[model samples]
Target chain A: MRHHKALFKFAIKAGEIMLRNGAETYRVEDTIERILRTQDLEIVESFVTPTGIFATMDEEDGETVTVVKRVRKRTIHLHKVALINHLSRQFVEGSLTLEEASQTLQEIESRKPYPPAIMIMSIGLAASFFTVVFGGSLRDFCSSLLIGIFLALLQQGFYNSRVSRFLVDLLGGSLIAVFALLFVNTGLGAQLDKIIIGSIMPLVPGVAITNAVRDTIEGDLVSGISRGVEAFFIAVSIAAGVGIVLKIWFAVNGGYIV
Target chain B: MILPMALQIISAFFATIFFSVMFNISRKELLYCGLSGGLGWSIYLISNQLGGSIVVSTFLGALAVSFLSRYLAILRKQPVTIFLISGTIPLVPGAGMYQTMYALITQDIEQAATYGSQTLQMAGVIAIAMIIISSLPKSAPEQRKAH
Candidate 1:
């Protein structure tokens, strides 16, 4: 009975880690089930959504346990997802003892993301390169690079603020437009539109949109709808951010510089 | 034209690499992510230059990205989402979304509607492309009940 309880806790912990790190709903459910089934449990089931996970298992002696883990935050860390996937596979293959598996999962859980300095630089470079991809000139690229750096800094500054993600994106979008306008107006950049577009690329909800579609296709309709709504709102916040700034600029300048 | 196309592809490769860093993908997989992004954007450019509409070109580009991601997932033993999300970044409708919102803010309702629907269509086609690729049957060895 104690062994079964430990097994259930371990499996649910693995699922929670996956869920918190942005694994798909079906993937989390599948991982939990695979891990639990390794012990010959009579009943094992897991239900996951974008926001929470519910799992229950039963033993042959009429001993049943259910655990519900509520996941409030999600960030894309595919490295963690891949690690947990590998761990679960090893556990299912019986190559790993339960203690070793749980210990490794603990280590994986505490793994930090890439260093902030590197992340900020990469965010800036991503925006600038995207500017070039969209046909921006060298001057525009330079301007976008600077704007991207500032946007990254802004996001980092707000990281611990507990503000809504949408608000951060909204501010990031406005900052991009403001910088683009200032650069173009001051003759530092040639294409205002290109610069704004490039810098905003970092804020786009590519992961959410893709995961939403994938979850829906995998028949996790609840996760799908919620993620789709997330993507839509993120897009809107970004647009509104840029739109408000552009509208104000146009009104002040009495012309369409966009 | 060829030079521009090559430039776009190269930029897309680097862009995707840095984007993957933001998503915290492991270091070893960064190069493959870049390769997939370059492949997707190259396909998009080629199809567009071949007279395909923007929507159709985007669909083809996403299709290529999805296929490459699945293949890389098997070869590298990583989750397919790691590649799929980063690779599709270059084809996402960020520019279109901006243009639509810009038109709307300027009170150009006609232009806004046009760009808005185009953006929606591009997003929709990308989703459909992913669904088609994911729904395809896998071979025996690589088969997993859940993807």
Candidate 2:
């Protein structure tokens, strides 16, 4: 009974790490069930959604243990997801002891994301390269590079705040538009639309949209719908942010700036 | 035209690499992510130049990315999402979404409707492509069958 309880803790902890780091719902459930089944539990079932995990392990001759882990925070850190995936597979394959697995999970959980400077530079370069992809010229690329860096700085500033993610995106969209407009109006950039589009790419909900579809297709209706709504709201917020700024600009300039 | 397409593909490669960095994908897998992105964008460009509709081209691009991600998931022994998320970044209709919002803000309702539907279609097709690829049988399902 004690061993079963420890195993349950390990499995749920692994699932929690995966969930909090943005693994898909199905994957988390699979990992938890796999971990629990390593001990020959007669009935092991796990239910995961975008926000929480519920699992029960029933042994034929032993007590049944149920665990519920509520996951509230999420960010895109695929490396952590992949690491837990590897760790769970190892534990299932019998190569890793329970203690080792728990220790590794702790390490993975405590792992920090890439340094802020590198992330900022990457974000800036991503925006600039996307400008080129969208047929922007050298001048437009330069402006987007600056805008992307500024946007990254803004995001870093908000990284520790308790602000809502959608509001951050809304602010991000407005920031991109504001900078794009500033550059164009000042003759430092050409093609306002291209710059805004490129800079906004960083803030789009690609992960949420993809995961929502994947979850839905895998028959996790609850997770799918919730993630889909998340994607929709994010899209709407970004659009609203950009729309408000452009509307004000249009009204002030008496015409379309582009 | 070919030169421009090549430029777009190369930029996609680097852009995906940088995006992967933001996603905290490991350094070892960054190159593969970049390759997947470049491959997907190349397909998008070629199909678009071949007169495919934007939606159809996005579907093909996403299809290619999904297959590549599955393959790399096996080859590199990593989760498919690492590659899929970054690979599909370029095809996620950010431009279309922006265009739609632009039209709406400018009170061009007709154009807004057109772009908005196109954006949704592109997103839908990408999802369908991923589903098709993921649902395909794996090499050794007997292991999964054991459960």
Candidate 3:
């Protein structure tokens, strides 16, 4: 049992590396992710139990490590923290060891979060709410909400990413817009923002975008920049939805010029 | 007037419970988490009602939760973020996201675009509120504790 927990025991060690490597968000950024990605390890009931990172994961050594996380405080060499960046700056060159640079990455990788079902549902609802709010009108709101949540759910249903996620989003937005309109013909009132807004609320990038901007303002440059990029992409996605729909509407109805 | 606000508090309460459960909160501590969130949300609503900025309201709400969690972390002997994230849900700018999105649905392109930027601002404000409220432990740049 002791041997099983030994491999992942470097968690605190990993944190030390964050400061040593001068990485942003301290590799603690991806805790849930790294634990889930281990091919050799099997975790049993690792919830945020009051016990501190509780779970029974079988280590490669055929032993169970009873993992319990606690308030980990340790002093680190602040000078070493600036050294990696200094070295890179002095070199002014691209050639660097993947090991050195990647050590920081591995630490970040370790902080990835677990995508729980309820959280996913919450995310979907939030996204739906955002779209519904923009769509306006009860019919538009409901359709957008339904579509956005459905699309987000599709991402879950297929474990989608990259290109697949993009395709699903486009399809999801289009489908929701079209269907919500169709449903409106069923005699729904004009004041349906409530339903629509609630549904699409999950789609808004508020949290991620807010976190990004806040990080930048808070002085976590790397995390702030990365989060900013993520926020930009989400914004772009929303823009694309607007552009595509507007183009279609223009072609058919001669609506206001974009 | 008060009912939806109470409903929102309830919604936030459930959200906190879900987060705590995921984190493996002790069963005995469950009510504390929910109540902390609900109470934090009520404070947020009240502050916003008093002509305080949403960001300011969120900050106050987060502060309420953070102080409580810090107390509970001592009383309950657990990490503060665990309690903080749960209790701070109601103040997370969930509603602003919809406001921006609703603005975008308009045929008025100019207005839609304006709302888009507004949406981003709200998001940034919310993040600031969250970050400001959660008192992070200081460490050297090299330290990489789990966030």
**Among all candidates shown, the one with the greatest lDDT:** 1
| Clashing residue pairs for model 2 | none
Query: Judged by TM-score, which candidate is best?
Result: 1
Ranked candidates, highest TM-score first = 1, 2, 3
Quote model 3's TM-score: 0.53
Per-chain TM-score of chain A in candidate 1 equals 0.97
For candidate 3, give the lDDT of residue B126. Answer: 52
Candidate 2 on A1-22: residue-level lDDT in tens?
7778788899999999889887
RMSD of 2: 1.7
Model 1 — TM-score against the truth? 0.98
Looking at model 3 chain A, report the run of 10 residues with the lowest lDDT sum: A73-82
Two-chain complex of model 3, DockQ on C-alpha atoms against the true structure? 0.09
B38-119 per-residue lDDT for model 3 (tens digits):
7787778789879987667766776677667666655654434445545654455434543454455545567657655655
Error of 1 at B146 (Å): 6.9
Clashing pairs in 1: none
lDDT of 2 at B104: 89
TM-score of each: 0.98, 0.97, 0.53
Model 2, B7-99: lDDT tens digits are 989999999999999999999999999999999999999999999999999999999999999888877888888999999999999899999
**Against the hidden true structure, what lDDT does model 1 obtain?**
0.92
lDDT tens digits, residue span A48-158, model 3: 311123334556666655554552221122223223333322222334332453465354434423355654554544433333323244354345445555655665665
Sort by DockQ, top down from the best: 1, 2, 3
Chain B, per-candidate TM-score = 0.97, 0.95, 0.68
